[model samples]
Target: MTSVGIDFGTTNSVVAHFAAGSPAVLSSDEPPADWAGLGFDRVLPTVFGRGLDDRPIFGWQAKQRPGSLAAVKRLLRAEERAEVDGIEYSVEEIATLIFGHLKRSGAAQGVGFDQAVVTIPANSRGIARYRTKLAAGMAGVQVQALINEPTAAAMSYSMRSATEETLMVVDWGGGTLDVTILRNVEGVFMEQASKGIQKLGGLDFDSALARLVLDTVSDSDRWTQDERTGFRLDVERAKIQLSELEEVSVPLPGGQYRRITRPMYEQVIQSQVHRVREPIEQCLKDLGGSASDIDALVLVGGTCKTPLIRRFVADAVGLSPAPGIDPMTAVAEGAAVASAILGGDLDDRDFFVSTEHALGTKVLNPNVGLVFSELIPRNHKLPARATETFTPVRDFQDQLQVEVVEGDPEKPLDDDDNVVLKEWTITLPEPRAFGEISIDLTYSYDVDGILHVHGEDSLGNVVLDEAVSYGASVDKRELTRIAQRVSRTLDEDRIAGPPGPSASSLSAADRQLVNDVQAKILPFIDDAEATQLRSAVTRLEGGDASAAAELQAATRQYSYLL
Candidate 1:
């Protein structure tokens, strides 16, 4: 069976497959003449557009549209459908569009991979990874394996380089920032430590650039969506130009233009530039070493291409980067190499899976009330399973809420913001606690990188055991509808049309805010309005505070009292 590793990135998605003796990225698939009008390349954009079509329009085909959207990867756990133009679409729907684009591109090269491996950020744990797998299933390719992005990159590096050395993989892409430290022992790549900041990426850089340009304008506070979007596009383009040129003049809306030199550009995003070093520093700290301890620094992702970042990481790591592969395709190439290994094509050696986040439950502390307790710590090798026993504070506790979150277990678990995986409640027949009954939470992470959670009584009876739930996955009809939707995209692939647009990002902390605010307000709005509110909340929660605030005010002012 043909197999490939898919880096379904925040900004762009790439596919690489095992071929004659090695893995290769399908980088030469250019859009057809008609598709060329949509403005695309080998790297499929992770975006969807607003339209009247039954299926979502995506990538370049989404450009110049009114309701064009991007960043569905970050919104995977979000249950609300985004309304663009007059249509509404779920997070899975938008993701399916992106995956479908990848399928079409692969098929264009006469390679429709039946078995595939999809890679996600090391921080993309629990439900986020499950949603990724679901998206792949929607695209008609059964996932053979799921690998962390940096691990796959390391696999790629080990494949090309025979020399054994300690190397660092800094994968700063459009939506997530992940760092992995690994060693090539003989031929096997062993990850020593890993860390990530899911909310940080290229989109943040774009937004910061937007803020810099907007600051030069008088009505920055009152800027409309159209105005913000236009500035975003221009500033984003100029930022890309600054990477190649010493300086770039960006045209802001309202006939304003400013010259942004590399130094000036760096200054605008200086705070964020410093933030990039955080995960790297933290990873090194976890390894009990300094930059000098790192033998070679491997840079991957488009944002890592910026001269300022490359120079800073090189200086910070105290080592010059190894020059061989393009940073942009490094992860895709690495994932491709991993796919080959998993497919048993390359028997050089093997790699291991590491959990990106701590897996645990929220339990009542004797003195502190409810707090998080971890069963599996971050970076633990998989397939990992762990169990912890606990008893209720009350003599007779009728119910137990088993909320398993993927985050810093050291942190106090206050709300859903601390969760990335699953949350389920177990109801007991009668009041029982302490000696009356013993509760055990069992977490088993499988080979597919999926987690199976189980709660049991001391008698060994299963209380709750299942995969983590998706906001929309609970509905059987919804799952069927999504499957049908994904299948249709394959059919649309044959039509040679339906390219549209989209954007990227996500984090754990915001989950709390969404659960509290959106749920209460949902009953007040219609389907169309609810979709818009969700997109607005997703944008606002994703650091688009401006758009979210404006929409909130507009809703309050124009409401017909329900």
Candidate 2:
């Protein structure tokens, strides 16, 4: 059996195998026939649908269904839930459906994979990762490891390069943007840190263009709700066209249409482009590295194929982006290379993986109040272990709370932020006195990067020996419930009504007043894009007070859409 590597992406997924000498992509029985013909041989859509019997039909077959939800990537949130034809599925189930397709595809290629490596965004949280692992388990594949996508891309790039150098891998995939700084130190790849914007990607840019098309129709009073939705779909096509052509004509209802220039599309998407840049700036700052210090800026992902994206990156990074590597398969290829290394099949070629952050407990001290004594330090090598002593504040204290936290100590304090407290309130019994120093907390990370926290007192008593897995935080089933409630709430609000009439919808006198304000604001609006101007107009026209609040939440959840 051969070891396989999978890049289970949001928009599309691919699998690869290492044979003879280099990693090669496998082929899938799906559309985009070229997916199976190129050097990166295998690629498949990640969409999956449930049948009446609750059995999932995956890949192109699932996507071919009428009204099929094609972008299952956005639905991967731990808190997202969906019901298709009265059958509910968690993000993990959908992922499993896709994985099953890959498994069958691999089997079709005459390769039975036992051990496999998977790629994920570097900044994926514990829950997202746990769900990914569960999805792999459902597919019946033994996950040899879960490597960061950019790290894998860096490794793949490093392997082809002659000189050892530090490079920044900008992985702007269909649904996510991840920026990683890596050092190829004498052939050992070491990842510094990675930052990501989950909602910033090709989809958001498409949506922005869609909105611009919708605005033109709305202005003409020719847009029905259905027509608006159709325009949204047309916008995606127009975006693809504008990417290739300087200008493209997007057809509207009644045989009428508007020509959109690349500059116009860029104007619509400028905000999203800025959103992608912000994270890269933060990632570089966090790494304490300069753009000048980076030996190269390597772009990976289908979205990176855009000329505007390439130009922006080249301008921002002070270096021309690399060429010749297939953005879509680079990460998957890098993952195969890493799998080869772990299987003891590859030589000393460096690629970076994010440092394993330690999970430790904080104890209450009489003199110090609460002090964090780390059992495992951040960036500790994987499959590693460390033990630490925790003394009770009181001599006979029977229990201690082991607050497991993951993050840099230097992060700003925010009382409302949950990221500040990654995990807390894991308790362990203290078997002896304070002077006796009764409990020992041991933290270890496995090959898959899942954490396990174990504790025992001075008497060799085990207080807790449980896996600190993602599913433990919340039931996977509840995620769908939360999502349903959230979706319903949003729909209800949308149907309730707009706050007031717009200037175009107002009386002539009122319109004049609105126009006076508009005259004052139009210059700023012209300088700003349509979306931002629309927001300002909505607020000025006394739109719902909750609009800003709702927008803020959406912005945080999908900041890439800004």
Q: If scored against the real structure, what TM-score would every candidate get?
A: 0.80, 0.71
Per TM-score, the best of the predicted structures is: 1
Tens-digit lDDT string for candidate 1 (1-562): 5658888888777888878877788853444453343213556667677546545666655643556777778787445567666667777767866777787778888887645888888877677777788677666666777788888887777767888888899898989888899888787887778888878888999988777766777866676767766666677677777888898888766677888888888987778878867788878888898888888788888788788898988888888778886666667777777777777877887787677677777766799897777778877887889988766657788777656667786666754437755566677655665677877877898865678777888767777766665752345346446655566655753221121112233234344335534644455445665677677676866666454344444333111110
Give lDDT per model, in order.
0.71, 0.64
Query: Which regions of candidate 1 deviate over 4 angstroms?
Result: 27-40, 51-55, 77-80, 218-230, 253-256, 392-397, 414-417, 429-434, 492-562
Best by lDDT: 1
- For each of the candidates, give the backbone clash count: 14, 4
> Can you write out model 2's per-residue Cα lDDT over 1-562, one digit (the tens) per residue?
4757899888778888878768888876455442233222346767666655546666666654543456675665444466654566566556655676687678777976645789887766444665676566545555778888888888778667857788888998878888888878887877775667766787878777877776666554655655654565566666766657899888887688888999988887776777667767866886787788889889998788778888898898999987668887888888888888888788776454553233445545688565454555544545667777777777677666556655443332221111322343434454455587667778666655566677777777777765554433544234333323333422312111113333423455444434543443333222333365356547645744444433333222111011
| Model 2 poorest 10 in a row by lDDT | 553-562
